[model samples]
Every structure is written in structure tokens, then in C-alpha cells.
Target: MLIFTNMKWQQALKDYKLYLKIERGLSKNSIDNYSRDVDKLIKYLDENKSSNLPINITSEIIQQFIYETSKTINARSQSRLISGLRSFFDYLIFEDYRASNPLELIESPKIGRKLPDTLSEEEIDQLINAVDLSKPQGERNRAILETLYGCGLRVSELINLKLSDLFFDEGFIKVTGKGDKQRFVPIVDITQKYINIYKNEVRNHLKIQPGFEDILFLNRRGKQLTRAMIFTITKQLAEKIGLKKSISPHTFRHSFATHLLENKADLRSIQLMLGHESITTTEIYVHLDKSHLSRALKEFHPRK
Candidate 1:
């Protein structure tokens, strides 16, 4: 067992990052988010000239920091920051660096569930149709948008998608989601056709980078596309079609789930396909389409 009574903020944070990465199997983005929360507290302590270590930091100090933070950020961001700090303190306690979490008594700000925005089927069709086939990158863009909606992929998952992850005969593509969890989402034939065209015609022509040869999506220089690029593509398409509603790659994911629920797909199946760890996370789709619930009631309820 390791012990450190006088561990500095930087050292504790370094160890916490490793714990998050190795022990928790969290993605790099998640580790960075958690570390940012602790970094904020460290900054506060430095500015105030507080010499408290991880083992001796008091709830009052943390509370003061939180109060100062609330002025600048929205309630949702504040709540997430609190939750992230709470996780850090919990880790410190687990490792015996502290007797208890300083954040245990702190209450996160109450925020209502923000429903995700979705695109209608017609809107999705319009966006896809807006892609100019004459452009060199047009086929690739079409494939990317189709894959985003068809597979219900997160931006990270869509970008990290590999050529080897495709199983066309089985009609499913492997997706690596948050925490490196893998799931196979079924792909429709139309989606598959676009991917094949991009892979065979557009992608094959590019001179792929050494490390990124296996990556499914590549930019003009044959490097993996960044998250920002995906956002830009979607935004430009929306603008080109004069779409009024604000949408992103995630909007496609939300539309996928909402459309499925509207067609009477089971919550559990949707949860599995979306790679949601909890059914409650998937339950939000039910609110997106209330008519499905009413239809079920009318068809199955004995009184109805």
C-alpha cells in the first residue's frame, strides 16, 4: 500500500489521472474533464495562498471555491463540476489519502433534464441530398452523415471507427463507445452501400497516413478527421439546405433513437444499440415520442 500525507496538488492529480485511465478505463476525454475539475480547485487554492494538501483540504475551502465558480458557469456545468470533484475526493478516500470526501456534504445545483434536439426523417433526407456529388470529398461526406444517423454513433465513436470493425455480412459494425466498451449496431443496406462507395472510390484514392491506415474516415491529407470537422460538415449542410433547426452530429444520434421509439422499438433494444449503460439514459427517447406510448396503451391495456 502507498501512503502520502504531504502529497502536493500536482502529484495527487497525476495519480488521480492514472487511476481514472488504468483502473476506471475511462477515455482520454473523460480523464481530461475530471482533471480539469481538480485543476480548478488547485487554482483557487493557489490564488488564495492556501497550503492545504489533499489529505487536509477542508469542506469550507471547497465550498468557497464552488460558490465562486457558480457565478461564471451555468447550473448544469456547475453540477458537473461538483460531481467531478466528488469523484476525485472519493478516489482519495479509497486510497487512504483522506479520511472522507470534502465534497460529501455539498449539494449539486438542481437542473432540469434538457431534452436532446432531433431531426425529422424529411430533414435528414434534405441534409443528405444537399451533399454535392461533384465535389471530391462529397461521397465521403455523404457516407459520414449516413453512418452517423444509421449507426447512432457518438462523434468520438464515428471518428475512431476502423475498417476492420466492419462486418458487412452480418450487417453490424463494431462501435467503441465511452470507457472503451464495444457494441455492434446493425447497419441498413443503404448505409452500407454509401460506406462501400466511399471506401472503394473516394477513400482508396487517398494516400493514407502510416498510423491512420486502418481508420475508416480520413481527411484530404489522409489523416483521421477531427471532431470539429464533423461539426463543420453538418453545419455547412444545414446552412446549404436552409435548415432552420440547429443540429450537430449528435442530433443525428438523437433522431435515430427518437425515430426508432416512434416505430415501437423496445427501450432495451434501443439502449443496447445506443450503448447506453443505463436504461434510464435510454428512457429519455420515450419523451421524444409520446404517441408510441399511447398506441401501446390502446393496443394492450385490458380497459382499452
Candidate 2:
């Protein structure tokens, strides 16, 4: 067991961050989270009279931390902490700081998945209509909202959309997802028209910055729009419409899938449109249509 204490834990942590960034290609936020978890373990060891060393930390100590963490935090937070710790140890293993990951045997908390909040047809209309068309960027804002609801794009996917991806001739847009994987999602003519209008009228007028030539959505400065900016725009519109239900841009995506499911679009089709890797996720829509579920329930189930 080696002690990182008395030695420079901060320096080692800094180097680990570089490794995560350069070698692992992890995002800055992810690297920060991994560092934060390691910091938590180091702080805990300092208080417990144990050595603040990666090699010295035992699986028993890691399990005890989980138990203590559960006492103070909810399951979700504990789960995040467990994941953070796992990533930290994996980094250590790569750096030869630890022989094995201590977190391998620790079980994650079981969390029941909750369905996403969806907007009713009227609410969806209110949200879209809330945009004041008279203002600058109005058409663009409307198009942004429309694309989100109509296409079911993740916020990141929406922000990172490239001009090369839009294939109006084929009626589909190429989307880059988690793991840098790309998939094609069909784009309706309505969304395509508005996007084209915004692109030609507003986006083309901006001073296009270097390296952002392929980006579809650009800010007034002509650089690509950010995820935060997209959220801010949608949030203001949600408020203007007096929508009591709290929602982000992502709520539009949920509403899109839900509306389709309610309208009798096939689950397999919806799953492919949503880019879900599994049918189980698409089946959540089945629960939304309990009244229309196939037979066997009417005959066998006591509740029916």
C-alpha cells in the first residue's frame, strides 16, 4: 500500500485529468466529476485516519463509503458517486496507481425509472404559438422548437447538427449520438421549410466564423449556438405561454414520441425514430395506451 499523502495528491490528480482528457477523450465535465470523486475519497481517508493513497484503499473501505453516502444522500446521488468512483479507479488502474479497481464488486443502488413528462396537444400548440413572430430570430426560434418536437433530437445532437447532415431531398437528417455513433432521422417538410427559411434569411446574414462552416445553427455572432442558449430560448417561451408544467427543451422530445404513440404509430417505428437501441424503451408508450391494449386482459385479468 503506497501513500499519495506526504507525496503530491494534487499533482497526481492533475496528471490524471490530462490523461482522461487526452487519452480517454472524455469531456471536461466528465474529467472534473472523476477528479471530484477521488477528492471525496481522499478527504474521507484524511478524516478517518486512513492513508490517502489509491493503492492502500480497500474494497471494504469503498463499500463503507457507499453505505455512509446512502445515509446522507438519495439513491441517484449515491449512484452518481459510485459511477464517479468507478471511473476514478479505472483511471488509476491505467496509470498503475492501483493493481485493481476497488469498485468492481460494489453494487449500484436500484432506481425505478420514471416516465418523461409530455405536453398535451393544446399545450404543444401554446408553446409553439408563444413565440412572437414579429421579433428578430423569431422564425429561427420557432424552427428550433419545431425541429426539437418534430424530430425528437437530444439537445447535444441538435446543437452539433452540421449543414452536411440535412438531406431535404431524402427527407432525413444525420444525427450524431452517444459514442460518436451516427444515425439518420426523417425530417418532415414543415420542419425542413422553417429551417431553410431561418438558414437562408437569418443564418446567412451573420459573419460566419472559421471552423464553423458546417454548423446548421449559429448565434448572432455566426458561431454555433450552445446547449445553454437553446435551453434559455425555450424556457422563456414556455413561461410566456403560461405553461405551469416545468420543462426544458427535452420535454418537446417526449411530447413528440407520446403524441405519435397515442395516434397509433407502430412502436417499432417510433423506437427507430427515437434512435433507442432497445424495444423495451419503446414499450413505455404501450403503457400510455392501456385502454387500447390487446385482449387477454379483458378475459383473464381481475382488474379488467
Candidate 3:
């Protein structure tokens, strides 16, 4: 390993975070996650009374930290932690601060492939219809649900949606997804109609804050809606309908992809629509409903 002296772990971590943000173009949420991984290692070092800096830290120490972490967290979380540490060490090697990565031989936990939960078409209809249109915010909530299910948007993308991003006439909305990557997703007229009603009837009347004038979804005071507020809205509706499944904003996205796949939408198209970087990510929708696979197999297979 390349030897260095007087380099502090805190300073190295700060520089690594900057590299993640600027050079790697990661989002704040992503940067925070990476930083948290480093923080855990620092905490481990402190607890063990190891004065080792980043340059001097060894694979043995890191492996010990990983071993300790695995005891308290699930396999999936352990896998993520190991992956994060690998990235950090890789960065150090790339910067020539170290000769080799500590995590080169480390492997992630072997967890089963977990499928996302999805709503049936009827269940989705029930949830949307459950919104009380008589209330002023009801139309807005309906629109939010429509966009979530229709466009397969992440919760972060939904809250960050701006008025300028909506090109209804062109039949697509510009979505800024993970890594600040922008893509256009087509919006159906029904989804458009609901959004327009909310914009014209309810959102139009609000005294919008100066900074939030272009935000599509807003609260009573016209401030941008927080992520927790969206979750609360969805949770309250689930309770109102007495739906049995534990769900979140992400459930709608999963339902969107699953439903489309069931209706014979090609995997490539779904990948594009969902803005997935890999087709493997989109392929999980296939596992959501097994009957679809059986039907496809029986219909096309020679034995059938």
C-alpha cells in the first residue's frame, strides 16, 4: 500500500464526499449515504481506540467493522454497507492515496431477490376513487396519485416536479431523476386532466411563496410539499380504505411497472419509461405476477 503520513480520516472523508458530489455527480441523498458509510468506520475506529488514519487503515480493520455491522443489520443492509466501503476504498486507490483497496476481496451477503409490492388495477382504482373530491385539496391528492401510478415516478422526483417540467401539449413531462439525469415521460390525457383541474381550481388560488412559484405540487401556504407529507397522504388513504398491504409512494411506482408488464409492454420499453439504468432492474416486474409468465409460456411454447 502507498504510505502517507499526517492525513486525517475526517479530511479524507470530506474530500471523498466532494469527489462523489462534483466528479461523480451524485445526488445529495447519494452523497449522504456514502458519507454515512465513512462515518460508521470512523465510529468503529473511535470505539476501538485505533488512531489509524485513512492511509493507514487496513483490510483487517475494515473487515472487522463489516463483521460488527452485520450483526446488527439485515443481510440487505450489510450488503449495502460492504458495497459502500468498497466504493470509498476504490476512490482512495484512484486518487493514489492508497496502493490497493481494502475491500477488494470482500463480497456482499447473498440475500434472496426481494420483489416489490404492487397494487392490482382494481385496488389502484379504489385508492384513487377514495379521495374526497369535495375537499379543496382532494383534486390535488388525486392528481398526485395519478402521476405516481401513471408515470412511475420516485417520491423524490414527484416532490421536485416543477410547472415548467410539465409539457402537457407535447404529452410528456421532463423528469429529473437520480444523478440529476433528465428524461421525458409521456403523460396520458386522463392524468393531464386531473393535474390541470388541481392547477386551475385549487393551486391557482394559493398565495405561492416567491421561491416556489414553479413547483407543481404545493401545500396550503404554497410551499413545496415535503417527502413526509406525501407519505402521510398515502398512509391516511390506505387506512381510510382499510387496505391490508403495507404500502408507500414506491408501491405506486412498482404497481405502474407491474401493470404495464402484465399488459404486454416490452421490457425495453418499461426500462425506458421507468428510467432504469439496467434492464435487470426492470426485469423484477416479471416476478411480481407469475400468471403473466405462465400465460406467455403456454401461449407461445411448442408443447402447448
Candidate 4:
């Protein structure tokens, strides 16, 4: 085997990060996740007193590391970690730092496809209505929930939304999704109405902070809202409505897709609106509303 000399784990990781960023065009969050996966293996090797170089690390050691870590994480996380390590090793191989990837033959643990939790249309209405209109943040909260459900936006995309992205005249708002890819999602009249009310009434009065002037959603202090804040807002609203199911910002997203599927929206259209990279990801909504599938069969099948 052709072995490259003096390739340390740290240097390999640094180079791999650059590769993911520039060559792969990965977003910062994605790059961090990929790097963190490899970091776990490096931590294990150091603690175990293994002196394996990046080019010289054997599959046995990698397998043992995975085995040890798998004890602490669930199957889904373990699968992701294994996939991440595989990508890292593949990068090393691509750079000719090693002749083969150590994780090449390792199998990921079997995991069932986890169904996403969704709120019913009535539940959604209750949750939104539960917000106290008397409070100064009420309009903003209402608009936030409306936008989340209306656009099926990921929490990251919601928080990062800007004034420049809004195109109400065109009936579409630009969304920057995972990997910084931008797509236009249609906004309904009601959602646009609430957003306009919040923008004109609540957001207009804030002593806007510097550099956050264009950010659509802002904290009371006139800064960008954190992802945690969005989760907290959803959790509070869910509790206020006596909702039993555990929910997050993602629940609204799932509900958005589920409700659409239940109402006979095409999977491909949902995929595009949800900004999913693959139709397979969007197909989960089909599973969420199996009755829709049954109804379709009854309506269109030759034998039915």
C-alpha cells in the first residue's frame, strides 16, 4: 500500500474541513457535523493510547471505536456517525493520504424510518389562537407560527429569513434552506396578512439593532432570534393549548406537509415547497396520511 508520510489527524481534519467547505460547498453547520464525527474517533484513539496516523489507521481500530461509541448513542445517531466517518476516510483516500478507507466495509446499524409528529388542523388553530393577543409579542408570535406552518420552513431558515427575501407582490418568499440553497415558497393571503400586521405594528416600533435591520424576526432586544427561542415559543404554545404530544418547531413543518398531503397535494410539489433535496424525504408525508393514499386508490384504481 502507498502510504503518505506525516499526515496527522488534526491536519487531515483541517484539510477535510476545507474540502467540505470549498470543494463540496457544504454549509457551516454541515461542515461542523462532519468534522465533529471524525473528532470523536480521534478522541477515542488518543484516550486508548493508539499512535495510528491518518494514513495508517486500521479498520479494526475504527470498528472498535465505533463499537465503544455505539454503546452511548442510539442507532440513528450511530448510523450518522458511521456515515460521517466513512465520508472522512473517503476524503483521505481521495487525497491519496491512504490507499483505502478504514470505514469502507463497516455496516451501519439497521434503523427503522422514524415518522415525524404532526398536529391536526384544529390543533394548529388552537395553538395559534392560544397566543395572548393582549401581549406586545402576540402579533409577532402569531406571525411566526403562521409563517412556520404556511411555508413549512425549517427553524434555521425561519430565523435567517430577511426583509429582502419577502416578495408578497409575487406571492412567494425566498427561503435559504440547507446548504445555503435558495428556493421560493408560496405564501397564502392569511399568512401574508399576519406577517404584514406584525411588520407594521410590532416590528416597526422596535429600536432596531445595527446589522440586524433586514432580519424579519427579531428578539425584543432587536436582534436575530436564536433557534432555541423558536423551540421555546412552540413549546410554550403547545403547553398553553394543553397539547399532550411533545412538539418542536419541526412539528409545524411536519404538520404543514401532512396537512397538504391529506388535502391531495402532489408529493413532488410538496418536495419542492418543502425544499427537500429528494422526493424520498417528502414521501414521509404520504406515510403520515395513509388515508390519502387509500382514497387515491379508491378513486383511481381500475378495480375500485
Tell me which of candidates 1 and 2 scores higher on TM-score: 1
Candidate 3: Cα lDDT at 26:
88
Query: Candidate 3, residues 113-224: lDDT per residue as tens digits?
Result: 9988888999899999999999989999999999999999999999999999999999999999988989899999999999999999999999999999999999999899
Candidate 2 displacement at residue 75 in angstroms: 2.2
For residues 1-304, what per-residue lDDT tens digits would candidate 4 score against the true structure? 1122223777889999999988887889899999999889878877777778888899999889999998899999999999999999899889888899888899999999899998999999999999998987899999999999999999999999999999999999999998788999999999999999999999999999999999999988999999999999999988888899999999999999999988998999999999988899898877766888889999999999
What TM-score does each of the candidates earn?
0.92, 0.77, 0.92, 0.92
Model 4 Cα shift for residue 71 (angstroms): 2.9
Candidate 3 has which clashing residue pairs, if any? none
Higher-lDDT candidate of 1 and 4: 1
Off by over 4 Å in 1: 1-7
Candidate 3 lDDT for residue 243? 99
* Candidate 1 backbone overlaps, count: 0
lDDT of 4 at 1: 15
- Per-residue lDDT for 10-102 in model 1, tens only? 899999999999999898999999999999988888777777888888999999999999999999999999999999999999899889999
Q: Is candidate 2 or candidate 3 better by lDDT?
A: 3
TM-score of 1: 0.92
Clashing pairs in 2: none
- Best by the lDDT measure: 1
Q: Write the per-residue lDDT of candidate 2 for residues 61-173, one digit (tens) a residue.
A: 99987787688889887888999888877888887888899999888889876678888988878888888888757888888988999899988889999999999999999
